[model samples]
Target: MLLKRAIGVAAGAAVVTAILVAPASGAGQADLDSAVREAMLAERGAAASADFGTPVLAEPLVEPTRSNDQGWAFGTTTIPAPDVEHAGPHTAIFVAHRQAQGWQVELDGTAEFVEAVERAPADVVSEGEKQLFARNYENSRVAVADTGLGLPWAEGVAWWMGGGPHGDSGQSRPFSSLDFNGGNGQVLSAGAGRVYKSCLRNGSGLVRVVHENGFSTTYYHMTGLTDLGDGQPVAYGDYLGRIDVGLPCGGSTTGPHVHFSLLRGDSHTKVDGQTIGGWTFREGAQAYGGYAERNGTQVGTGGRITNHGQGTSTPTGVVESGQNTSVNVRSEPRLSAPVVDELPDGSVVRIKCTARGDFVDGVWGRTDLWNQRDVGGWISDGFLYTGSDGPIAPAC
Candidate 1:
């Protein structure tokens, strides 16, 4: 289900003047601007503090545009860092939708809002087109590896079957539900990645992690949670939370069990067509009936698996101090690969893949500085430490 959180608008006659005035199908630039300003004011007032004064929107919102197919508009705004709670400049994307009365604040956040906007087209367009676009994007960005996944629970923990291989029935998608023998069990991340969402609300508690390889794994029906926040990096075998069977955590579950689902992409909209370790995930399939093998060895099954090799070809590494204080990120994987950007000491980067390059100190590691625009190149493995021994990440 799409989680909708209502934005609180301050009640006042002056505030009413800022209400959005737009057509039924689309919002004009003036309406969008008014909506953005009003939403920012409300958000700032809600986050105000005496020590920090009042948070004000930085002038000149970025990427102010209306939705192509809906009565919605969005803009990215910058909030200057203050002296109190929020100490750094923060960026937010605000969304406003038209209503019978006027335009109102709908949603605001970072990538999540971006995703919501992307999915809005599906509401007006054909579902087939949406699925096709999703598949195309997945094929372009994702390359599944043959690494086995670690079973989410600890060893010797016997879990009963709560649900298995369900089809797309309402809110439930393709997933397996493992019921804890004692009404609860420890839930662990299926692989190493960043915690995308740790949302617990509306009778549902879940954790979604985006793996280095562009795939995402979700664990739902959790009760106790770890201290991991959104966008926090997590290592393989990290404990996420505990499973619970009842309401407020496990949404509409009959028993206490963790619902696990491997996805093809980071967004929830791209959950279909998931393929892990070369096995295509199917709806209504048995959780334990399927099997995956690596080099003729039975490594994982549909139900239980290890996080051994279930990641993308890209490996995450940190920029260590080389002969220089910073490393030059190039457009390609060689010394002559045209420097695109520079990475300071202790900077974390994702190595898209290794390439046989101009050997420097017996190292030939290459990476694409994905986070930085116009930055990508190869760095010597001598300066890039992947925390893992040998090259477990796939070759480019």
Candidate 2:
């Protein structure tokens, strides 16, 4: 099944775009991801057209979700960043299994709109391609010195499960020592990239490499090491530094382990320091190239086909849609009240309530229906098909 690939992001939105800044060292995890997402959206939007519609929430929505097996929650709505949508904000989402391809996809708001999440490249290493695989086991502990089974590089699900920590239980016995055949703190490249950042006074707290493909992989918590000039390019598996399990020099870690991460394009997707292996530990970004030509016109809390006649919403700030969709509204946007009945996607929601800002949740923009204000919550801006009627397109 091959479809025409469309351009990403809006046409010529590069004006309000922000710059990408790599953290020196000790950069906060949240800050890192935010920078990456914004840059990607800007790029994607440049090529974006009206073909794909982004789901906009009246408010933000946060819920627990499964990214790989990490079981981390995320904000469902994903808006395109100002400058790029073609590059897209680095995000992860659970694709519905109904698609038959067995490939995961970006689950934006409506399930009906998805075609495919991730399509494998022509030469992608499929299952039958490799006969037998040897797990790169340094000491039999998953996250310590583990590499892809009999492979040098890894991506997607295989990397999420293999690269991070694993045990019998969440509190299983730790590995006493991995294979003595290699260095402990010896950091290898998570992927090919240049040294965007080095061990500095205050940064991601380790050496950060920016790959050619805009991905950034970090080698965190180093104890002993020599200095390499920042921005120096290196191959995969290059020596970064050594780590002592007992030290907390750079970003504090429980034991000696290199904190690895993958930042798609924009080069600075932050890794929240809690350290959940495999899954990128960030939300999957879902952005469209342009406004989903809405014919039915999603009615806001004003009940009429208007922004209360105050002109259409002219948001000045960035609206994040991926895992940290703090800008979405979950309840109905009919009136200044909460929704009483539980409605799924595609349900005709009457604007029973409309409260400016947020009510229950802390989303920046929230709205409620008038009739059902009790169980009714924020209508989440990132839903497919605004207002009440239309040609029924897929949500991004």
Q: Tell me the deviation in Å of residue 40 in model 2.
A: 16
Q: Which stretches of candidate 1 lie over 4 Å from their true place?
A: 1-140, 143-149, 154-162, 168-184, 196-204, 266-396
For model 1 the local lDDT of residue 211 reads 57
Q: Report the backbone clash tally of model 2.
A: 84
lDDT of 2 by residue, 306-384 (tens): 1111111210111233344233334454335444433433243323233333322313233321122223454443332
lDDT (C-alpha, whole model) for all candidates? 0.45, 0.28
What lDDT would candidate 1 get against the real structure? 0.45
Residue 3 CA displacement from its true place in model 1, Å? 20
Question: Candidate 2: where are CA atoms >4 Å away?
Answer: 1-183, 202-204, 245-251, 267-396
lDDT of 2: 0.28
Q: Give the TM-score of candidate 1.
A: 0.37
Candidate that scores best on lDDT? 1
